[model samples]
Target chain A: MINDNSEIILSVRDLRATVDGTEILKGLNLEVRAGEIHAIMGLNGSGKSTFSKVLAGHPDYEVTAGEIHFKGQDVLELDPHDRATAGIFLAFQYPLEIPGVSNRDFLRVAFNAHRKARGEDEIDVFDFDDLIEEKLDVVKMDASFLDRSVNEGFSGGEKKRNEILQMALLEPALSILDETDSGLDIDALKTVAGGVNQLANADNAVVLITHYQRLLDYIVPDFVHVMADGRIITTGGKDLAKQLESRGYEWVLEEFRAGVTA
Target chain B: MATVSDVSVLRTADQRDAYLKGLVQIAQAAVPENLALEEVRSRAASFLNEQTFPSTRQEDWRFTDLSAMLAIDFATTGEASVTEADIAELRLPETAGAQVVVVNGRVSRELSQLGSLPEGAVVGSLGDRPELQSQLADRLAQASGNHEVFTALNTVGFTDAVVVWLPRNQVVETPIQIIYVSQAQGDSLLVQPRCLVVAESGSALTLVEDYWGNSTATHFTNAVTELWLDANAQITHSRIEREGTGTFHIGKTVVTQARDSQYIGVAAGFGAKLARHNWEIYQTGEQTTTRIYGLGAISATQHADTHSLVALSHPHGIVEQEHKAIVDGKAHSVFNGRMAVAQKAQLTNASQLNRNLLLSDQARIDTKPQLEIVADNVKCAHGATVSQLQSDEIFYLQSRGISAPQAQRLLIYAFAMEILDRIPVETLRSRLAEAITQWP
Candidate 1:
């Protein structure tokens, strides 16, 4: 049921990736287009997180065989930073605590890198202060957060909010949220989901990777895919998430196996 | 009878000859008419004659080899003419203070600007102020004894000394800046720069010592600084050493704190082919506070060594020390920090930490943090860590659109900023930040 006219922001074909000689994403295929939000739900060790890391070209994961194209260009050949400047963003589940680097300086460097890649004028300190102040409101963060080190000594909820703050500043075309709601409470989840909904538009897309279907309740997805054994065995509408939440993944896996045998 | 190899015999012979030649030249030079000064010089010369340049055979010199330094045929002449223009570019920007310029170990009155100081405050060359001879003679060689070869050499060969003295109950509003610029006029010139700072009881002072050199010449800077803080005196000392890439530098700083005194030392080493700094602090009286912080950034085959010791001899003394090194390329960095609490120093609290970051595969770091507590009721802790940059940290930054090099630079800057941020002066902090960010 994919739209024909919508732009194909990301396309994956028979992707295979491994970490330390152990295969993680085995024969996975997914296509994401503009104006669509896709959700990937799986149990533990089901390769849901591995898929997002592979998409970001993480050094620990090696792409044994895959073809990934983003906006009509090969993305697998790009470095992680080049992929980022090419408008791909991955919100980490656990943000690193970088001591001594101020949050303001870190954000400015990230923003300037993207601007420089796009041949735009770099923003100075005064201008950046003004710019980041506006973006901080998206996550309901205080200005004092900018003075402290990046994610250092921050609570889990604050760290997630910071991830969303960076996402707002970068404004990538394709955003991958890998378990961004796991440690967040209901209130933080709502705020983060609201920010994501506002940032999403017809010209951009999102891929939410999560273990629970609760996050999809706040931000409804255009498509829901069930990943099992490093591959998506079934795909459906928003109702699939409701059914999986009420029941469990066992029935779905049983039906997929039956269908394969028949 | 001794089975000394030809190479060892030749090296010992060269070192002995250099010592004798240096002593003769220093003795033949113009001497101060003061008897105490003459005795100090003669005692230092005899000490130098009894000792030789230490090699890797010594425990303190195990990680640091002085063969390259001793191999050079050093010039004994102390006279090197330097104009105001020669030192114009070496001054710190946006720093307003009383300036004392020392060129080739000789204080330059033409280049010095002894601005109006507080009452009872004196800032000038020791030769100019013969009235302060008693103060100099009492504290000149008190901190650094003649046991060390480098300190003894500085004590013997120093042409003139920069003295910053504050009488009782006097406070200097502005920091006193001492700039030592080494400009070599010939091959392998030796310049001994000496400074003596005496802060009387109930006085306060902030001192900044900046050392730089002409990058085109090969020289040796043997520098010594003695700081004596009387009861209730407080002093902040900052030493910034950025010498020429082909130069050899050995600096000794000895601090003595009396009862209820406070001493803080912040040092940064960035430039030199081979550099070594020895800092020793003695808490002579009760209830003294001592803090020492040091940072060294070396790259491209440069070697830097920092050895610091804090001794608490009286009761209720406190000390906190931290030294960090960032080594890149084939550079080498060594840090040795020692905290000693004597038997009489009950309730003494001391902590020492040495952290090193190696940026390249071939980069090397040797860190040792030592604590020896003889008192039963003392608290002492020491730790050291040597690590390389984590790849995951770099990737995390890269995921945010920062290039790899930019991410590495930011991380390294953050690592160094921990020490640089502690500097109270904003101008000095920013200048050092820029230097570390642009470092290879």
Candidate 2:
């Protein structure tokens, strides 16, 4: 149970999710407090995407036995867009290519959808243009990029930056950046991290979902969680990320072996 | 009560003869023009006299057997007056410029609004312009000779047609919308409506032909539109054919793009018994571009056929087309898109693509995208795909709280917007969007 004054926005207890009758996230437990940036690192097939997708209410993942609470509400009952409107955002590792829908219009609809769910009036077209213009600067995207279809023929860095732009526009309470650093060059990584840093606030949190430790150097997560076998095996301060960066995941496996023998 | 009086007349061949005789009188009274129109009529009569009714033996008419469609023995509908309220009901969102209304195949002066046109703009029926009749008549003979009997019949029997002429450098601000509404009685009738659009050098104009029917009874509509783009002129044509369920329609458009000119044509078929639309874009000049796109949504026991061909006979010409069809129930849809690049068209870039989505197991579609490139230096490609909605997309949408019907609507609308977004008019786009919003 979470304490009354914990400032915890999301608390998952013994969360187990499955897909096609195969267990993916097995007994995973975590707590994310506001104002803290947490980085989840794991190897391939480690269920990193599945964990985040289960939280985002992806239909493919079936949560067999678990209790998920978001702002003290049962998140398991919410839909994908509802979970999003309820302040949980998942930047897809592989964004969907939706042709015919312009990037500007998609962002506008998503922004207003979240706003309307929060009892705010929808922004007019003129106001929306101005707002997008301001946010485009955060990702260093050109004005012409907004007129193109939503990630139809976007480059690798452009798609990641477009995700960040959407994250900045919607301003969700818990923004889970799923491999946002993947396929991004060093320059693009710094730009995307800078945009995330600007949106970090005391009332909102960010969870950086990635497999590489290199991205942690630029974003500098407050806490590092190493996941293995569909569950987080260790959690530590920022130095843990750097140690894993130098020695790799084998160091943690040695410690796990030694502890078991002891 | 009236059925008994016509029971004996329905069996003999005289029934068909009497109806044709009355139709001839209606055509002569409405369009007794100069010698050129007379020549067109005489040629059409000769073709009709030599040929029998269209049967299933014809390749194009195989699926849609027209024997029953022609069996509906009805007289030609005469001229009917419409009130202001009727005209207002047919209003499209964008109507600040030229609005011409043709009721029952004849242009209605009381329902038209051509006051906003510039001094040199011409907006009237083809019967009113005898000088341009010879020019159009000469072109029709050289172009695709009316091999299709229906087209030949329409050309020969056409009475009222809207003709728009834009002089040099005259930029029309608002789109010219021609509203065609048919109110046919229980009797079967054939109405041939034609439109001629000529754009001079450096001129720009938008034209829209909106077809509608108010009757619940069976009706047939045959329409054709011709466009001539001069040097450096640009024209955007949008045709929306939304007839009733019992309506049978055959609509064709032919456009000739000149040097440095651009032509974009889009045809949307929403409702009809059997709808066939052919778009032919011939680029006879250097550095001309033509873009064509069509979408057909057929349901119930309907059949829709759309054939388009882009001929690049000149150098440095470009053409692209994307056609799609969504068939449900037992309906069958066909899309034949062809692009031919001539030998001398060295720098032509031509492409054609047809994609179909079949909703039901019994629903069928035949999509053929052909590209014949005789030029060695040209780049041409053609592709076609026939498939169903991805189950993953449906599950994704359903996971977002959209129900099954709503998800289906979203996917279908998304499929349609692929072609609908190319429409240049904002008002027409929104109107089409609104029509899609309440998908049945």
Candidate 3:
């Protein structure tokens, strides 16, 4: 029940997804083993977000046909909340604004749900307060944030930091940071990356779905994958991210086209 | 009594006479021999004679259509006895402090629980208390400027109503709950119930009114509640209207807050065939604050009108009002809220907002939020919005694996959360949420 296997934490084969009846991801395949950080980079509309959303089981996108395995269990049948409770955390690119639920209450509910799903005893309120206090130090979040509504009027950097704070609380096996670095300044990015790094361990894997390579400079990745037209076109070591950063996505497309023509 | 009754325009006139005649009879039987209530009774009688029931011609009564109530040949459902079933249904968890049961406009002592009160705390029917007549008797029938004929009617026709008094430095820990239940059977039954609450200096108390009815017989309910909070006094009041079908109900409440006093009014309108509630709050003293939050869910062919007007007549006064409604089927709902700040009411801060959700194509909602400021230093703002659910929000929720209906429900709940979350009482908020969730 704890997913003790040391093999792959997540596997995807020929994942095709559609949003609002428009096909976004044609065919995508990737595998992530334990203790690895993967960075995905591509141009806008290249299906980077679609892949992350499909994995997280977002409601609007329907999979015509695909195979996704999380800890050797089928994940396509799970709901978003279920996926979240099943050791899969998705840091939304734009977190929802829930006006009445406080940040502390939301974190507590999410944390306890995952713990219960893992067959562990639910965290007591006192223990939760202690645990959350410790995690807040990693993000440098003030205590006032615990009383405010969930992401209501939160700044871009604060929202991203809150995401990492939640990640520290949930401790998921395969955490997907969906463009978590979009709205952060350099200092905020460093602080957020530091929180993420502290949560990274041998038992879990991280997927950094991003467009810029700047975030990769802070949170170094083991593998870099290039997605084009809803499919993963190229995969390489961390050097690939640097190469893409200098040459842009058009260079890789030109090289691929040249290979096809030849 | 008038000599001749030409039934044409004399319908309201004759009704007024009959109402006064019944009140006089009840006063003779119920009031104590030594209580000097003749002046209060005469003033109410004269006020009733000068006022006329509002018709469709008046803008405030345009959508209400009280013609059915005016034309109904109804007799007063007076001195009705409460059955065991009626007593059994008068139970509410938060009403453990002091309870008063009014059946068909008459107080039932056997069904009430008048809990122990602090020194100088008084709880009895307004008509039964001749001592209070010396102070609040004249202000009870003062002109409200607006043509609220029902309030005048209630003032004249009220047979039995509760009057609560909290003296200086006394705090009533338990909320005094007045349960108004309509058990009148058959058609053409009418009832006018009145309730008054007065909290003196440095006193703190809470009052709750739970209104309901059994029989579906066609009837009219003219109800009024007057609240007066003296200097440094605090009052929290909540009312629930669960009237049955085939009932034409009108409720008017006037709350005047004094210096450094705090008053909060929360109302939930759940069931009514045609119901209208008028809430008027006037801050007559400096540093007073009043907050009113209301929720209404009307469906089918029913009609509900909820109007709130708050006036800051003194400097450093504050008023906050928010109302939300969910209208479905062919029902029509109206919310009119206005905040007025007088010239001398500088440093006043007032805000009003009305938000509505139209669930069906045929459902209609009319909301008007206004702020009239004569003071240059006051801060005032008002806004009203009427719209259906957003498709993108719905799709977003659905994409998260929530079903269509469930997603809509959550969005509706989110829309109403602004007011629901503001409620100070947690259990009542949850109960209100449960009621909204179970809406058919």
Candidate 4:
């Protein structure tokens, strides 16, 4: 599905950002195209999550210098919701528990917001119910989750599935899944990965951020990236992920250090 | 700021006694010739003579300043006509036939729609039913409730009182509704509305008391409601205070629970320049249960206060209470919940919480959870919190494509819905929710 004629969904050049007066993402660059899956692998403090948040326009991350272009349109000036309605989706690392807002209501409001942005009429409750039920099937979710408050009492696995369900509903062109497989059991991870695979198409792309390579086994990525100290140190084909899996990250750090010295 | 300015507003002894004595005279003039009510009015009138207008100097009225009421002169309910169309929107379809409408504190028979009642169940004015009238002489205003100034004033001069009585083991199928509307003619009036409910052993019923101002005239509404639950009886009550902006409403709801009886009350206040609700519950028997939930949403210069007391006197008593306030603009909201566990009330379990959300920098909130537990074997927990909307919650909503302002509205709705959901009537719950969302 990697077509040379496909348009680029996301292009970040020299992105520098900070939070609470501390620089986190420093001089990072990346590019994502249509129908391609890229896995950004890093250690816990390698700034992978901060990169995803900055791309999604989180308020806390102040981009001091950089340019974010989505479909050749500058997105750094956009608000988080405006960016979301402009077809960029970020699955949070920890989904919030809204105690009184129903899941069905939340999903409908989100869907209608996207619809309004697209100049389409908002769907009624009955129609939205059918639409959400269909998307729930993509994540193997039960119908009872729609009646409860949004993520109020959900387990780790259920919250992940709910996020995926929202992604399936919004149908964004560029998706950033932030640690979607962290808290899931084997079965839940497979189900979540299966849903992502089902939604992948030639016109859409996904950027997966994870600390482990186990998720790449189910949803094969076209590129695997290794990040360190707020920069992507090295990137390679899918085989590099396997090599990094067998030979620990310290080996790559030493090799990187040698290359830098030479 | 308000405390400093209110220092000079305190009334002298002559002014206090004169203002209260004037109100007592107005109430006594409206008193009917019924012999059954004469004794109650006489006793309350004697008590009201020595009382005066409450000021900010008093402990109970510290955060509440009633000096503004000194400027207005209130009259009796003289020929005030309120048609059905005035209260059509306030009526709930759930209580279609089992409803009574009180206009200017007198029963408006033309507007009430009490279709039918069971053989032992009675729902109507207190004077119409002889059985309730006989019980009213002994049961009304019997509890040692809070704010004696207002309750005694209402008992002395209320024109008519609504009564709900259920015999032993007679469970009413339909919920009883009492719609109290106030309308002033020519001048400002004092709308004193009263209600009494008695549930015998093994009987159960749900009651809704709605206080709605039907006119734009400035008025003073003093309301009092007394509930009695015998052994094994249950009563669920919902009190809604959405008075007019020009009105000042002060109400008292007192309850007495017998052995094994349960009482659950949900009250919400949204309107009126100054509104206060004194809710008190007393336990007389063992194994009694009480649940209270309250909410007040105010903006602009409005002031809303709720003072609640739950006294557990018997063993194995249980209580749970939660009160919330949403204050915006320069408005003020107060909540003081007291839980008193006596020595005889062994093994009592009680918990209380008061949470306030200040939406503006100028808004004010005063909340206190007082626990006085003399019994060493009892379990009691109390807490209070004052905060604005969480930044993370708003961002979480915004991340989902909802705009910031809409996200704030959604969060406020969610915060208040916890108490609004306890309302038994579907129409009533939705209406109150809508009002909160539409609050300015």
Candidate 5:
């Protein structure tokens, strides 16, 4: 139902960010349209994770020069929590383990926070129980996981699944998955990717930041952008991922350098 | 161990001399006469006359300075007149139990509820009960020796006491609640409340003690509680102190456990301008278990200290102690935990942990965990940690749509839940959680 004519959900132009006085993101440009799955592939230390953190308004990452507009509002002025309530969700690669806090309680607070931000009535505990029960099925998680502390002693795959579970509950307009497939096994990868594919629709967009091409095999991307040296060097269709997978990034780097000099 | 010259120098005009003078005046006016505890009280009074208040030079009183408390000239007074309506307002909401009210160091019989208790269990004023003379003479002041000046002072000046006695093989289904309320009429007042709990062999009891007072007046609450558990006896003791911010509170709890006995203590300190609690436990017989968990939250120029000592003189004893303090604003928290295992106490397992969370840059925490094991076969471990809120943890919660303040509160509650969850009473646990959430 969605095509290139769909509305733009996120737009970033000439973004420059620094952490601890060291610049990581330099003059980066990106745009995400509604209903499209965009995959950003890059080598190590290519500012892939920094971009996601900057969009989420992490306090440590300072935006030196950039313009970020989310849903027609300047996102740079909003706090991280405000960004989240405004329908932006970031799935962390390494989820924090908060001991003594039940996962169900955490989910309830997060769900109600988004609803309250939209001027809607907050659901009670009983209604929330029923609502969260349905969201658990999206990630194929057992109901018993709700009773334990949030990621206190969960396995690698379980943490990732919990992240996706939260994304499902918030129902964000733009969801960014940052290396969510790194620590997972083949079975867990299929489950998480399947969950993401099911949640993607004509109204919401998803951005996958990964280093490997195997994830594309499960949830095909509408566009693949290869990033190097803090900027996107090339953009192509789905075949570009295959080409990079078979030939590696060395040829792409050499061609980019040659083009830059010419 | 002072020389004649040093003694003469100390005998000159000083803060200790001022306190000694005040103690004499109070003893002359406040000491009750011709009771069953006459000899015990006399001996404690003599000990108090010879001793002086501890200064910062002493090891135990190093971190907790009493200069400000000592500066105030407090008067020891009898019971303050309080109406039934006043007592009703201080009762815990939705609580079902046998409640005992103590106002200004005297037990209020009309306000106490004793009909719910079993026949064998006794909950009455120490001044009215002459039948418990022998039991009081034997167990009173047994755990806390004359070394600590404050405990000795409490024994000397206490007008009346509350006794909760469970006879042999008796088990009480409901918890016994003791509420101590302090009120000042005009001047700065001092109140000393004494509690004695004796659990006979094969008996079980759960006791809750609450300390609260008026917020408009300046007062000092000095309390002492002695617990004696016979063989195979079990007792769960919970003490909650939430006095006014203008008040000074100093409390001491001494527990003695016999063979096959179990003792669990949950102590929370959340009030007072200067609050200090000293917990001392003595293991007399083998195969005894002791668990002590404490939480202290102080803010806005308040100072709170918890000092605990567990001595294992018997074999096959187990002890676990965990104490945490959350300090904000300009408050200061201090914890000193000591575990001593004797040579005869083989196969003893003991562990002590002290964790503190500082919420402000100006807040401070001093934690010292000491473990002494004379037996080679004993397993004893101790740890202490002080940290601020992790930025990443806060950010992680914020990224989930939770605001910064909500995230910090959730993290703090979670940090305290480690000990709060172990409380047996459901209402008290939730009440403490609510207090933690509402703390500024």
Candidate 6:
């Protein structure tokens, strides 16, 4: 869904972040514009996920030296929830299981919180029910999931689909899918990726952080970036994901180190 | 109003132990005319003669310190000065016509709204109906744990009690309620509220005993409730304690279940400066079912303790118990669950668990599960857990646009709702849920 030269939704410059006082993302740079889907591919500990967490203002991920601007507003001063209301959604890699809270109640509360933040009238239970039932079709989820506890005893694929379902309901401008394809089977992955593809319009952008190229087939990306040593080493088109699939990440790391030394 | 001599008598109090003696003496002033009632009162008086206020050295009172109550020379008798309008909000709509109101331990006939009792069903004070007097003669103050200190204290002093007696195969469709509202008038008062319920064979009843108040002054309330269940009978009991601020509340719920009977109890506490509930259930019949659940949500220097015991004597019985507490600020909570399975109780299934949520660093929780099994072929399991809200769970909610405080409220509500949702009355459940929502 790449449109004409669109508005820049997010811009991160020299993003240096740490977790537990240990540096994870060092001098990372990323620029995401509206209507563009970017795929960040890397091996373990390469700081791709850290970049997403830091962008979302996670309490533990400290941004010691970085500049993150969402729609030209400084995101560092806002709280985590404020960042969410500002249209930055980070789909968790490992969704948490919360017992005793029904899925429908949790979604309703989340939706009402957003509405309250925008000074709009919050939707009641009956109206929200209609809205949620319509949104459930995007992820192909059964209505029974609405009554059960949030993510409790849910299958891995079910949990992944729930994350995408949230994306559909929220309609965020910048969605960071952190390994949304990790736990899904083929059918579930297709459904979840289709959800993401449908939500990405000319007004919003999507950032996918994954280790495999299988998800890229369902949701085509406008650009493919390889990350090494906490920074993007290479940026290319969709064919770059095919190249990384054929040749593993070792060659990219080797070339990155070679260039660093030279 | 207390006479000048009564004030002089209360000034004789020296220590906390002397405070107990003075209370027993003051409660002994009124004597029942019924010979059977007098005999029960004298028997409890003898038991209270050798008993004193429990100390921390005692195992039962280890975590609860009763010294705070000793500072007040409480009057055993006070003029109940409450109007029906004062208790309007405390009355439940579900128990409209079937509710009994007791102010300062005396039944207010003007305030009680008793529906038409079916044939052979009685709902009133001890002397409300003379025909059933003989039937309840030997049944008064005769439960297994009647000899306990506070239980004897209530027996020695309570002026009036709400009694519900049903004949064989009788069924009460409405949930009967006994509302005890406390108010410390003139001076610090000691109000002893008592209740007795007997469900005969093949009968079923749902009972709710609500202790409510909103006064800022302190009061001492010692409440005792006893239930006798016959074979093939079913009973559901809900005991809710929300005394006024700075009130010291000690309550006991004793039950004896016959064979093929079912008893379920849900005890919850929220609004006392210091509160303790002793729940004792005994299974005398085989093929019985018992479930006990408790919850305490307190904060701001309050202390709440619960002691429960389920003793199984017959074979083919089942029991399940769960206790939870949400302690915040400097508040402290204690839970002691004991399960005893005798040799005759073969093929029994029993399980108990205590879960606590500590919301502040200074808050304290002490929990213990004691199980004693004498039967070799029985199944018994018990466990306890004390925890703080998980950071990851809060972060998950915060990422969804909920503020940190609201996220915390949601998590705490979920934790406490695990037990509160099981309360049988819908309005009561929602009211308590709303209280938990607004709890600091």
lDDT of 6 by residue, B170-282 (tens): 99988888899998566688888889899999999988889998886778899999999999999998899998877899999999999999999999999889999999998
Cα lDDT tens digits for candidate 3, B134-232: 676545655352235567556545677688888898988777778888866456667777887888899998887878886677767778888888899
As for TM-score, the candidate ahead, 4 or 6, is 6
Tens digits of per-residue lDDT, candidate 1, B1-440, equal: 55569777777768766765664465336344542387777787787767766778788999998777655667756457788788776555434548899988878888888765766788889878777877677788767444688887777667788998899989886878899999866778777889999999989988889898757577888899999999999999889999999888999999989999999899999988889999999888999999889999999999999999888889999898889999999999998888888999999988888889998999999888777888999888888889888888888899999988889999999999988887766677888899888886
**Candidate 3 C-alpha lDDT tens digits along A97-179:** 76655777667766766676678898998899889999999999998999898788999998888888888877788899999
**Model 4, range B1-440, lDDT digits (tens) per residue?**
54854664543546777888888888878877662476777788777776788878798899999988877788885687788779999889889899999988988889999996678687888756545565676688777772399999998888788988899999987888899988876757798999989999999999999999745668899999999999999999999998998889999999999999999999999888899999999999999999999999999999999999999999999999999999999999988898899999999989998989899999999987889999899988888999998877777777778888878898889889989999998999998888877776
Interface RMSD (Cα, Å) for model 2: 3.7
For residue A148, model 1's alpha carbon misses the true position, in angstroms, by 0.7
Label model 6 with its docking quality class: medium
- The worst-scoring run of ten residues by lDDT in candidate 2 chain A lies at A1-10
Each candidate's interface RMSD: 0.6, 3.7, 4.7, 1.0, 0.5, 0.7
Residue B333 Cα positional deviation in candidate 5, in Å, after optimal superposition: 0.4
Could you give candidate 5's per-residue lDDT for residues B1-440 as a string of tens digits?
A: 99998885576436676786586467446867645366776777777767767778679999998767667778886447776787675565433448889988888888887778889888878887867777677788767544577887787778788999999989998888899988877667888899999999999999889998757577888899999999999999989898888888999999999999999999988889899999999899998999999999889899999999998999999999999999999999999998889998999988888999999999989998988889889888788999999999999999999999999999999888878887887888887887677776
| Tens digits of per-residue lDDT for model 2, B1-440 | 64865775444335444444544444445554452476767776676665544556566656566655645754455556567786686576576548998877778887888777888888877765677776666554234535556666566667677888898989887888998877664446667787778898999999888887755567768787778888999999889888777777888788878899999888888887888887888887899988888988888888999988888888999888889998999999988777888898898887788889899998989877767889899878778998898755554443333444655776787788889888888878877877875653
Cα lDDT computed for each candidate against the true fold = 0.87, 0.78, 0.78, 0.88, 0.88, 0.88
Q: What is the TM-score of chain A alone in each candidate?
A: 0.98, 0.95, 0.95, 0.98, 0.98, 0.98
Among these predicted structures, which one has the highest DockQ? 5
DockQ score of candidate 4? 0.70
Cα lDDT, model 3, residue A139? 96
lDDT of 1 by residue, A1-262 (tens): 2566999999999999999999988899999999899999988998999999888878999999979999989988899999999999999999899998999999999999999999999999999999999999999999999999999999998999999999999999999999999988999999999889988899899999988889998988999999999889999998999999999999999998999899
Stretches of model 4 off by over 4 angstroms after superposition: A250-262, B1-13, B127-132, B214-216
Cand. 5 Cα-lDDT? 0.88
Candidate 6, residues A93-119, lDDT tens digits: the string is: 999998888899999999888888889
Candidate 6 clash pair list = none
Candidate ranking under TM-score, highest first, comes to: 5, 6, 1, 4, 2, 3
Q: lDDT, candidate 2, residue B133?
A: 74
Per-model TM-score, in order, reads: 0.95, 0.86, 0.82, 0.94, 0.96, 0.96
Q: Which ranges in model 6 have alpha carbons more than 4 Å from their true place?
A: B1-16, B30-36
